[model samples]
Target chain A: MIPDDALVTATWDDLIERDGQALALSGNDVSLLSELATAAVLFCAEGDATVSAIAAHLEELFGAPEGADTSAAVREVLTTLQNRGVVSITG
Target chain B: MPWESGTAFRVLIVDAGNQGRSAVGERLLRRHLALNGIPADVIRVTSAGLNADDGLRMDVGAAAQVERLGGNAHGFRTRSVSAAMVEAATMLICGTWWEREELCIRYPRARGRAFTLSEIAHLYEELAVAAPIFDHPRLLDSRLRSSEVPDDFDLPPWEEFEERIVAVCDAIDEATRWIAEIWASMVPHHPQPKADGEEAAEPTCTLDAFGVAVAITCGGSAHEALSIAGKRAWGRCVVEDREAEADLTIVVDPDPDVLADARLTGALAYQDVDTALHHLSSAVTVRAIEARVGQLIMMHAAGLAGPDGSVVGFVAPSGTGKTTLSRTLGAHYGYVTDETLAVAPDLTVLPYAKPLSVIDALTHVKEQWGADSLDLAPLPDAPLRLTRLVILDRRENGPSTPVLTRLGHLEGIAMLAEQLSYLSKIPGQLHALSDLVDAVGGLSLLTYRDVKTVLPLMPVLLAGSRR
Candidate 1:
């Protein structure tokens, strides 16, 4: 299951309203989060899963583009979210 | 009794030979000051060469370049740079560092008064940071001159030389305005006497870029504080009285409870003026001002003007390094407003020239530093058209190198909307922002940590909208 702390509980507007405009994310970040949120919701439904399993699920659902490394992209996105305090990973 | 009453601020431009460098510098300086609205009667400009023979005309190429820049080249006879000439001049500007040094060596007393054109620009920048309130020209005349005399860089060909002259003229124009603004602020304004028993007019308060106006009802200390802040932010727009009409009215409340409460009532406020001011941050004041002017379509952005009178706006939320980047790039591009960039219906940027809010070390309060205090060139007098927008994405430990990705119209609007001061108040805010995005074509998302990495990309970002 996804940790409560890992999830960005507040919506974009909610965050902006609470912390003022500076906390508002860029459009690209919001889009990236939307994609990640979808994966996150599905991952939570599956309970605890490995990073590879999550990446595989994303690849299967979205389909990896030609010459694109879906696993690395998923890891990078997850790492970015984690760095931004939007997500947390547990063993 | 007086030899000459009200002699103008005389500037003598000197070169090794007056035919070329001195003539060009003189013409540029004179034309620049005149173009920028500094009256000719207020500042007299002349040129002379140290080693020049009497009656030698300006160099053919330099004279043509001066003519091209709309400056007079006729009757430009080269006079020799004498001790008497040096003594007469209030300010002596040299075409080259060597010329300045030679003049200093010949006339030791002229050392403090004489400076190379580039040296004066550098000194102005330095003095702005160190002692912003001092009369720059007078201070520059009295201060100890630099001993270093570097050789002049090779001048470009005649065709390209005109471009350099234009650049020099622009620099002078900016510097002259900066000095005038600072000096003007230091001089206390004396209201003119009423003519023929006319009634005293009600005091009117004009708001600055952030749309903040302080009423005359406030205490003396509060008035003083607000006046300084207002002058720094809006120049001479901060007016007295007008409590009824002002966007924000600050009144000193003597009542203990009211003092403790710090109550805000619509556009009015009751607070312990001294205590409130002591604790109040510029950011909070700006936010309050934004709330007051939220009815108007304004954005929290730093505005800069390019050479072509085009404005590039960097819109971002507070603490996003908008001010930092604006200060860094303002020398190259004229600084408009760092706190609030108000846009007209046609998207022309109104000149704000507000003092920058610098974070105080101990209190961490954002103290207002006058625009002239910063080493930034002044904005040109003409209206600036909005040519570009950049949504800043500065974060700690982010990428070392800045990456600027272009945003689509809708995306640009979305990003810009978040930075809009009074988005909800404006009826068609989104559409207005969308129209601006469409007109400007698109915006760039500037993501980076250090300002240095992003500094080089500013010209590219400014030019990107034109494409």
Candidate 2:
């Protein structure tokens, strides 16, 4: 999980949505992101955004899917995005 | 895609003559990268012209704009766009659609990587800054239909490239309208809009063949002239029943203002009647194929049926005389389609006898002529069947007699795959294709020097010929 105050930024050029799904492409590599993941990516992409700010924005755009561990899911998405190279997190 | 990756990532900006737009793009992109702390050595940005005059400086107006935009264009010299440049460039952005298309047409391999300056700029903004995405509309919809699974990730490289090229071609066309509108707005005193398409309606016609039918509704200015010309050119496909249902409906209009408005509204519009009809042939053909994308096995080949209904489909590249053979041998057989021939799994041949686009040497325009107008054999009442498939191998100093060499299973399928469209969407697509190859016994490569030499082989090569 990314630290609450860590800097988060997007590294993709274009996020293309095709057939109800969004994909962020880096060179030939394309990563499929869900709707929540998409919103989180946009939130974290803004300059000086932190993990806590990204979760708060997600809280507004998408509420918890009825007792599904919302913060844990957001953390999971951030971790995946970082591993996918679509997002950068730094202390 | 990484800024500091060892894999070389070069972006090449292009325009016709390379004097203005491309120079601005090159300078601006370089400055953009620098502003973001990306080293110039990491990402290479250059510009070229399709037909450049080797050593020319950036246009003065463009250079001034570059300076105004806080970018230096001090030593920018135009370089001719070459095969080497296209090969070296990871991304090629052009100033106009014509340049993009011409480059793509010349080097189909670059089809996937080519983009317009306007398009790449939008991409650049997002790439560099991931600029506060607010659900920006995707540039182009996926070429795959809604039903296709999201497994588009697994497409072969060439197929992916082809799809990207098609998608980009369409997207670039749409993007160009925005560029034009922006230019129009920038001019303080723009010309007033032209009159809309409000002329009296023209005679409507129903065209049906190959199980693919279209109802042509004539509207707009010059509709009467265009309608009559279309009717004349596609008379072979026209039927008596005007009320017959069609698989597709196309509006034939050629009003300039209407065309311009259509472009703005994301509709297919042509500037003039000739242009409309010229593009209509391929557009309609593809539409017909789309209608039966999964239902039929279609190929870019010419089909002709002998008297007893044995139809031989000949696959050949452009300038290899598929049309010539269709027109010449068609006198003694039923002419199907010179462009797209469709077949059902049961071997039933569906004829798409659209007007042939023949090159007129004098005017150098490809004139469309109906099969009946050209005295080509008409579609007979006898049911047509797919009897044989022949790939034409034309050569200058070849044998006097046409030799039919039987092709192997993999060789035939691989060669034929290059010519078919929308096959991937079909269920068991390759298996279906292979079944057709096996069902028809096998395919043959017809190596010949002249059409006359290939003529005699038809009666023997094709089943039910002269029956």
Give the candidate number with the greatest DockQ: 2
TM-score of chain A of each: 0.52, 0.82
TM-scores for every candidate against the unseen true structure: 0.42, 0.52
Candidate 2 structure quality by residue, lDDT tens digits, B9-106: 46788878888767777777776444322344445779899888889998886776677667787988889988789867766777776888888877
The alpha-carbon deviation from the true structure for residue B259 of candidate 1, after best TM-score superposition, in angstroms, is 3.4
Per-model lDDT: 0.56, 0.64
What are the chain B TM-scores of all models?
0.47, 0.60
For model 1, what is the alpha-carbon lDDT of residue B439? Answer: 74
Clashes of 2: 1
Q: Pick the candidate with the highest TM-score.
A: 2
Q: What is the fnat of candidate 2? A: 0.00
* DockQ per model, Cα: 0.01, 0.02
DockQ value for model 2: 0.02
